[model samples]
Target chain A: MLERIRIVLIGTSHPGNIGGVARAMHNMGLADLALVAPRCEVITQDSISRASGADHLLHSTQVFATIEEAVADCTLAVGASARSRTLPWPMLTPRELADRLPSECQAPSARVALVFGREDSGLTNAELQRCHAHVHIPTNADFSSLNLAAAVQVLAYECRMAWLSQTDNQQPASDPGDTVRPVTVLEADDELASHAALERYFEHLERVLVAIEFHDPDKPRQLMARLRRLYLRARPEQMEMNILRGILSATEKAAQRKHHHE
Target chain B: MLERIRIVLIGTSHPGNIGGVARAMHNMGLADLALVAPRCEVITQDSISRASGADHLLHSTQVFATIEEAVADCTLAVGASARSRTLPWPMLTPRELADRLPSECQAPSARVALVFGREDSGLTNAELQRCHAHVHIPTNADFSSLNLAAAVQVLAYECRMAWLSQTDNQQPASDPGDTVRPVTVLEADDELASHAALERYFEHLERVLVAIEFHDPDKPRQLMARLRRLYLRARPEQMEMNILRGILSATEKAAQRKHHHE
Candidate 1:
């Protein structure tokens, strides 16, 4: 699904940025590049020179007169925005965007388009409205702007990761006797939120109890949240979950015994 | 065991080679690099510039006046030599040298040294004599001579691979109920006997085998040499010796059974 996605750059001003964007795409195994009314010439010798060894990507780039034409075939259009919008149309970080692509896109022909804005002023209201979703690359609050090429690199990297995850799910069976090593990739935000969501649910329960003054204000709310991060970092397997659940049951039983004695 | 094998360089000529040697050591997870009689100035701008980010190694480098003083306390010395010596000594390849170091010198006071020679002429006969063994790097016969830095890189790489194998062997021990992994240097040739003594033992074995007509002349001497190399590569343990003896007994039993049936 990530490979099927097209990255469309709108009105890019710098020839070097065009070249760099091409190089960045090539670095992350993303080859499809579309230019929408680019301010500078994309086929200049300077652009090709800056592209280094990614001349092939530059050569195969498709040019479009408008943003709509660039993403006409795209079913899911993601507008790259640096600023938060008043009416939030599901804002996603680079990590969230990565998860949304293959995991969420059920249709095979659901063409995913990552729309990059101009180097100077970002996408206008009309331009942003064309996109199905909004994606904001997390940067320093003071200087939130990122280089055009770097932005492409991050998005391309995320797309490649998401694509790899999908492909890995389709691997053939391994032999029972073969030496196996389990590799767990660290989660990038939204994947982390599933764990955080459980923590939030616990926090809500604690809040309700606290509001009713059922528990002391000085009492610590550290127990569940502490366990959450520890277990999340460990990224325990299914069998480990059973072991933890058994331990939890034993702890509950011990607490009941103390209550009965009291 | 790798920690016991101290890598000592004598009269190093190039700063880049020093840096490259440090990088090679880093790549192999070997941090010990001792410089004796360094021609190139220690920890200079040139050395630091070439070391890139591996300047920590250059920072920790210990300088000595002579190679003898540097390796005076060492129990086992393995010298890197390019040329064949008239006076024979135990010779080992980089992999063989890696297999040799780990477990034999269990005494905390015991030190094992791997001495690399000068850029122009390799270790002198006197220097080679001080070494308990000689290590010859296998290279292209047409162009066997490798750069000083490259030779260290190759040796360090082989050492690292062996070190990783040893580490992997220890990995099962991390799990309880599993028997402790033996730390014995079984795959390394025994350093107990000196070269001349081993040669005398080999001659005696050859004479005894010939007297018994154990080998046929038509088989060629190459087969025996190949078998010797294979056994040397295995660096068999005491338990493995028993296993081999058991197999020999089984073969003899089968031969006796065939004779009785005939």
Candidate 2:
């Protein structure tokens, strides 16, 4: 994946940021750094000094005269932007981007480029159009703008994480269909009763709610709707529902004794 | 889980590693650092400087005179090691260690201790015995030795990942079974199914065994026992029981078809 990924900085003005991007990529296990029409000199001693230990990668980096040249061989392209675009290339969260990249592009021959536009203007609509996906790194909504290197760092970090998650997913699951189901489906007349058998329990619950003064004749429909929504939202599992029903039954019996005294 | 995790360095020789461990724990969303009879002077100015932004963890860190004192209040204790121990504690892969800790302890007040032994020898047998579980981080077998900070980083990372997973799990566990069943019950279900259900399935399954002549009459019980062990070890879920029943039904139909042919 690292081999396939080319981190492209398009029209970047700052030489130091280009160097910092190199360092960030190295930190995140990505090595292929690409420069697209960079406004600043990307390989001077100043840039190299800022690149630190990552100077080797900066030395071997690919410089593109145009965005097209930067992404020519790339099969999948993701454009980075803090703000929403006019056409809005499908916006992917950091987690989503991390998930999408590795699974969608596995072939070693597949070139994947992440384009970061110039610091001042960011990616143009035309540049974003060439890309398949838009990558958004969540920041404080009031102040969302991030430095070019910081943006590159976040993307690089997410890309590496996404790759790790993909590998973890591919790791042989001990059991197929092991994921837990939310609703309990019990077959009727079996030791476990199915959803159909639970209707009586629901009805009993409604009666108890009415007795508790939570439901009134004037607001029957609204109250029932609210109750149903609450119960459904809670999504009580088989055991939880059973335990709850048991509690309600006990409460009802207690209420009956009070009426008997009256 | 973040609150409970107390990273205890047992007989740590380097002050630098202690500082480094703080950084690792902070990075992995773990606080509550503990030092168990460190050889070097911890909490010094140099150590704090190495700790960078994690000084608060260092300041609040507890220094214990003995390993037992460090872990006495801990409900769950995990000893981190790269290799197998002659003395058996519940051996957990870092992943498994991560999984068990959060499930086993939910009370924010409950203590969970992660014991990392001296940088030179790792956890001693006697020291490891004090732990409830032994966690082995997956590393290259050829070069499994990891720096103290790196080991802490990996285990802390696994723990944070586990904590995040619980958050994800809590987000509407569509399965009613999970909602009501205390996590321990779910874990028990994962370990083994109810004996009664296993017996019932085996009864229906035995007829198929006879039709297939899979076992001789004299060894019928023994074969059934083996099959029981195999499934009990696998810890079949509710859906798995359905699949097993379906297979048994198919086998019965196949036998009936063969009898008609005869």
**Alpha carbon lDDT of residue B5, candidate 2?**
78
Candidate 2 local Cα displacement, residue B194, angstroms:
28
lDDT of 2 by residue, A1-262 (tens): 7567889989988787787677667755678998888888878876775465678888898887888998998898989976666775577655567777775668867988899998778999999999998876543333344556656665665565555455453323443122111122211121343566466666876686554344456766554553444344333446445555654554444444444544
Instruction: Give the 10-residue window scoring lowest on summed lDDT in candidate 2 chain A.
Output: A179-188
What lDDT score belongs to each candidate, Candidate 1 first?
0.59, 0.63
> What local lDDT does model 2 show for residue B198?
49
CAPRI tier for the interface of model 1 = incorrect
- In candidate 2, clashing pairs total 6
| Predicted candidate 1 versus true structure: per-residue lDDT over A1-262, tens digit per residue | 6467788999999887787677666655667899999999898886785465676878899999999899998888999988656665666766568777775556877788899999778888788888888887543333445556656766775675566467553324442111111221221111223454545444543443333233344765553343343345444334333333432333233333433444
Tens-place lDDT per residue, model 1, B96-186, is 5655555645545556778888876767776775565667654322234445555665566445445545544332332111122344442
Q: What DockQ does each listed candidate score?
A: 0.01, 0.02
